[model samples]
Target: MPRATDAPPTATPADAGPAGGDHLGHGLRTRHLTMMGLGSAIGAGLFLGSGVGIATAGPAVLVSYAIAGVLVVLVMRMLAEMASALPASGSFSVYAERALGRWAGFTLGWVYWFTLIMVLGAEITGVARIVTGWLPGVPQWGVALVVVAVFAAANLAGVRKFGELEFWFALVKVAAIVVFLVLGVLLVLGLLPGTDPVGTTNLLGQGGFAPEGVGGVAAGLLVVVFAFGGIEIVTIAAAEARDPQRAVGRATRTILWRILLFYVGSVAIIVLVLPWDAPVLQEGPFVAVLDVAGLPGAARLMEAVVVIALLSAFNANVYATSRMVYSLAGRGDGPAVLRRVSRRDVPWVAVLVSVAFGVVAVGLNWALPDTLLGILLNAVGAALLVVWVLVAVAQLRLRPRLEAEARARGEELPLRMWGYPWLTWATLAALAGLVVLMLADGTARGQLLATAGLVAVVVGIYGVTALVRRRRAAA
Candidate 1:
């Protein structure tokens, strides 16, 4: 059990280049980090995807969201504890390397990178579809291509500029949700101009709150769990903040409660306002609520907001995937060329390579216009589960050492896990249960199998590469 400092350095001096160095720029501020987390977590999942959850479990979908929300809060706490102690662009991947081994780090890094890449494809495709609705003649793939290009350019500009753009994007999402929540509450209470009290009709009357029973709740959990995937970007961005430890601590603390409110609150409102079986739920839950509230042109307005949400998420995922690959390269797990940085302290090569899949997905949109998003979503659903499992394991193994080090230095840890070992273990068990649930459901089983295949491929590649390098050195 070697300590993090005792482990071999993930990056070496040789990795540094003349152009701004190999290191990522510390350009993110506390506000930027906080909003990026919000921007990432609140995207397609809530706006467009939650409808699937409601449809699956009826109002009992709240149970699914609550379960997922609690899991995210615990996982983020574990991640924040580790990130505050040892922040890096790789974030949990770096921690996994130290606490588990290089193999774990390599597998987690590559798996997470691929996961975000798939998510990038989904986000851009989602946005392109929404945009095409506004301009019927524009080709969806064309819009996807333009979006991929715009975000690529924005990411290449530098971290600060990227952070500023994400800040505003997330702000718009948060504001829209706030207004929606207020309107929902007013409408439910019969406070809106011409509306009567909706009462508990939607909640209790909707197939007795669990239309499909426990099986449906399980299915809903599978659908909604992935919504919490992007919140980890906060920990990743912490590496680039002016003060990683302080900024990460603050951001993680506030983000947990906010996410719960936004996700759980919004879902509750939707189910309370509209029938769980409403056909409009499939279209867009947020928009459906607004439309039912009698707001003029609510459909168009919310559709526009959803486009922004998808774009915001697309931008954040681009940043996350590029940094993950850049970190992987720096650590010798990926190609060394990805370590190259631009004059603005941006990982130019990694940014380009990361978005390359989005470009490919543009073609997929053109080819498989109807089914591309569902395919991508199902493929990547279980990836976050794997990543979170690793994060918890890494924290479990590292927390004791971190505490010992803090004690030796006569200081308290900047941020501590809420209930170490106990809560950490509980979170792991909950994640395992989610995996079991995924296996039980037919659709989720496919996603779990796909993610399993991806992880196996990554692990096999890493193992073979390591053996080759070892033999080469011996020869």
Candidate 2:
């Protein structure tokens, strides 16, 4: 890979934007962060998994989305409140370390790192399979490698270039989703030419809206929570923005609304367009609506759209995982070697190591792509719940200090979490309830157990490593 020829960056305070030599370029703008969040939310899951939610909960899936979307909004607000005050590249990891302790930071950071790597593999595997489906002759792992390599190279480019790549990649899917919503709305209202209106029958007729009962909604809730996993990338990107405080504040406010619209709005349209039990529901609700609405090339177009969504996610997650590892390394939680940045101020070494996860992902896709992959993805996703729980805790602990510091300096806080401790505690309770619900579901039970096991391993690693280093120092 090509390297940056620029001189090493100077050391700056850890609280400020990336430390000189250790920093990512502050080239990101508000639009970049906003779109990145949007791109992260509208991934292959929405493109495909929404159909499953519909199938499982029937029209009551709308309620599932509403419940999940509200939780995401509250979680983001809590995160943004802290992030705006303490803009560090490490985001929540730094917050945990500050409010909790090194043990807390190490646990959350590595668990999040592992989750990102596992997801990267899923992304590569999904895209590779898509390619093999189209070409018919190419091997799956081979194509997966090519996709990972291409994005790795793109990520290796300077930060501004990575932003541009993500911006456009995300734009394609955003446009597709918007067009989908418009067409769906028109079809539902009988406003489109030569089309009978898709009335409320599909939503009302299917054993009533909550056809599967509250248990079904509970099942769908677990899936909904996982779908919102990648949206946290916005906060990760926040520390690299030119105006970290302002950019993060603005993006946090708008990103949630946009994500809700894309998820809730689009899913509602699909359910209204076709009954939950439609024979073709398994294919994807988005495609079903397009086909029924007499759209040209619906199947082929959706395939292309899905490919774009996965590739976009692949690119963004590569950027995310690299930065995350870079954060861990910077804190001396991992290899010091990963702390170095390139001439362009890119975390090149970290990029390669993160891409190594993609390599792991490819191998997984080649081997036990079924049960094992499902279990791993679910377990890793559940970690996001832990990260969120800690974020709220961190703010409850840190926000008072942040406010006091601002007062001594005689400056007003730029962003705030609504209702302070009250809302924050409520969000924490909601997260806890969601976890219990997740554990209760038969399908999701395995994943929750896997998460508990993974958490134990992470804590164990931290404890043993800390003990060894302390003894070595004493010796």
Candidate 3:
């Protein structure tokens, strides 16, 4: 198939204002991109969802996390290479179009947008529940509506304002994780006042590592892999950065080790400090660790942090979904109205349309709290995997052309994926293996099937639309 041409590799400072061409505002600084990468990924998945992985695989959950972390690193490295070379709001979806075809980009973009919309609903619902816990008289749906409204207004303000808001929100999350890691290390070493060395008792003592065996570790992998989902927002956000190449390079390089440290490091600490079978793991592993360390008000502090994490993720997702649809509209794959921008260069129509689901979902949550939300969330469980697989595939297809273009220009690419075809192939293999595992696991099977159905629907729509356009031209 003939490849689509790449987006021009041009960038302007975020302060360039409305003069920065007909595109999303370049309002994100390096700090905003960096912190957004961190904050976006470290959400309820780590604080609340990780315990399920631990319960499934014992201390061997670290292996699951390690595998997933390495995959993310490889995937990000590939994305950094493409994103730096051809920065665009569409990010990997654009790369898919260039490397594969328009159909690939259209499918990936719409599916990802749908995934984020569903996630926005879940995030708002989670945040609302947390707030309702603190203020009992407040209704959950009311809190959800207010939270959605506030974030939507913040996003509509302007890209700079949104970047600044995300920067501060992410800072809170990163600081919380750093503090937790520091305290966890001290507590483990018996350095905390009045604590004995925990040693490796909890890690090896509880059913000897892989108690549930390889099957358990595989189950754990399924649980923790999706935790890495939101980090891809960095690439999407990179298009809005003052210097896309520099910002993407720095963020992708550092995000890997930081996520590994935050995720694998934190998980290692949790298992080392507390037995895998401890009932408290189910409640919240980080909070449980602090409680064990005898930190006063640990539960409340962690609860507040979890709320912050969810809100931060919600804010980032709003930015990501809007940019993606705006990119689609710009390419004539979506409604033309979605391409409208404000004086501040914000895609106002796209922003509102992206968050529209959250508003409707609030009512859905209020009406059918149990069934509808779970089905929506579950349907998108495997969406990130689909996106990652496309990123790897697009990188594989585009790398040679990119390298040749770089040589023709007498310059080197801004970033290159380490090991090229070898590592990229390995990442694809691992992703395929993950799909097999998901298919085999009863709980994950439904999600995988649902996602496949979503992909099919997207492709079908693209096909029908293409046929209609061709017929109209012929007529």
Candidate 4:
């Protein structure tokens, strides 16, 4: 394998922008890569947003998760192909640049960076709200401030330290969900204390399982699509992994099943243990299930879990946000200062900037209590979908070229994306459908606009850079 710096320079684009040719530090391990994947994929959304999906689709929400899960599986396969072929800190953004063109990469990279930063802000805000509930006199902003500082320090320590911290954080959430799943199965079997098996009747009895119909399922897909947003963090983390290609293969192969069990299994338990129409489902579905299961301390337990979820997301998002910025700078996509790495091999400058952005977002939320995090988060959500589409497009263009390269070198390509152009096309159509679905939802529509606006800003910057380069070349 060629060192990034040793790899031959790409044929310059007609308007050749700066090439991201630096070698990323090899600081991450196999374990870190695997756990980062878990940390990124499992978040508060599963614990919280599934409630929204259930409210919209009822029992049919399970189908929604299943459908979305299949789509993510396909996307991961595409991601794995590129990550294995060319492991880079920039992940799919680099693939987009190398495979498609410079502007495509630059746009997706910046868009993803913006999305993660806003998401980090939302995580801080979310954790603060939960913390305030436990400690009333403390202002929510104070808690959010403290949460961001602590996680930022942890991230600045180094990639290995960040991974170890995330491993335990991911472990707790994973264990709790597993316990919930076990208990749910028991309760459904009439084995749990003080409860009769609700039987399978609830699955079909209430609104015939598809009460809201296929459109309900389609609407549910909107929420489910957002749920998979964090999975791509695996690819970003892979660049530093001990053996990136293998780590990606392992994580990509296993992620879908874990998500299905954790999400679909947990939701299934919630529905079986309590009525799908239960009032608590409108608030927090997990709490609703635990309350009915006769847990003596369900609220306390859930509050603790939600706080952990928020903090875990906070830690992972900060790391992800900073790395994206560092990659951008390393690749000449942003300010040069962001490319500096500390003695610990951590990109501290990028880390501080990302944390500062999070702190500012927290302050805005505090000043405008009526305003929701959605305003800041909308562009991010839209950017996530766009990045995935870009990955699909990148693979569609690059895979054949890569295969040809491997054949010429007398090396068989290992681990290809499952289907060729057709499966790739199907995935794109699915993404297109999701974007349309998001547009139909009034709340999500604003996010689409903001995302479009953000992309436009990046494109404008690209145009300016191209013109400047052309003028200098002519001179």
What is candidate 4's lDDT per residue for 149-168, written digit by digit as tens? 78889987878888889888
- In candidate 4 the C-alpha lDDT for residue 11 amounts to 26
Ranking by lDDT: 1, 3, 2, 4
By TM-score, rank the candidates, best first: 1, 3, 2, 4
> Model-by-model lDDT, in order?
0.87, 0.82, 0.87, 0.78
lDDT: the better of candidates 3 and 4 = 3
The digit string of per-residue lDDT tens for model 1 on 1-475 reads: 1122211464463255558477777889999999999888888778888999999899999999999899999999999999888888888899999899999999999999988888888888888888888899999999998998899999999999999999999999999999999999998899999899998999999578898998888888888887887889998888888888899999988888999999999999999999999999998898888887889988888888888999998999889999888777877788887888888888888899978888899999999998999888767758888889999999999999988987888877899998789999999999999888888878778888988999999999999999998999799
lDDT, residue 353, candidate 1: 91
Alpha-carbon TM-score of each model against the true structure: 0.95, 0.94, 0.95, 0.93
Score candidate 4 by TM-score against the native.
0.93
Error of 1 at 150 (Å): 1.3
User: What number of clashing residue pairs does each candidate have, in the order they appear?
Assistant: 0, 1, 1, 0
lDDT of 3 by residue, 363-430 (tens): 97798664665666776769998999999999999999988988888888899999989999999999
Task: List the lowest-lDDT window of 10 residues for candidate 4.
Answer: 11-20
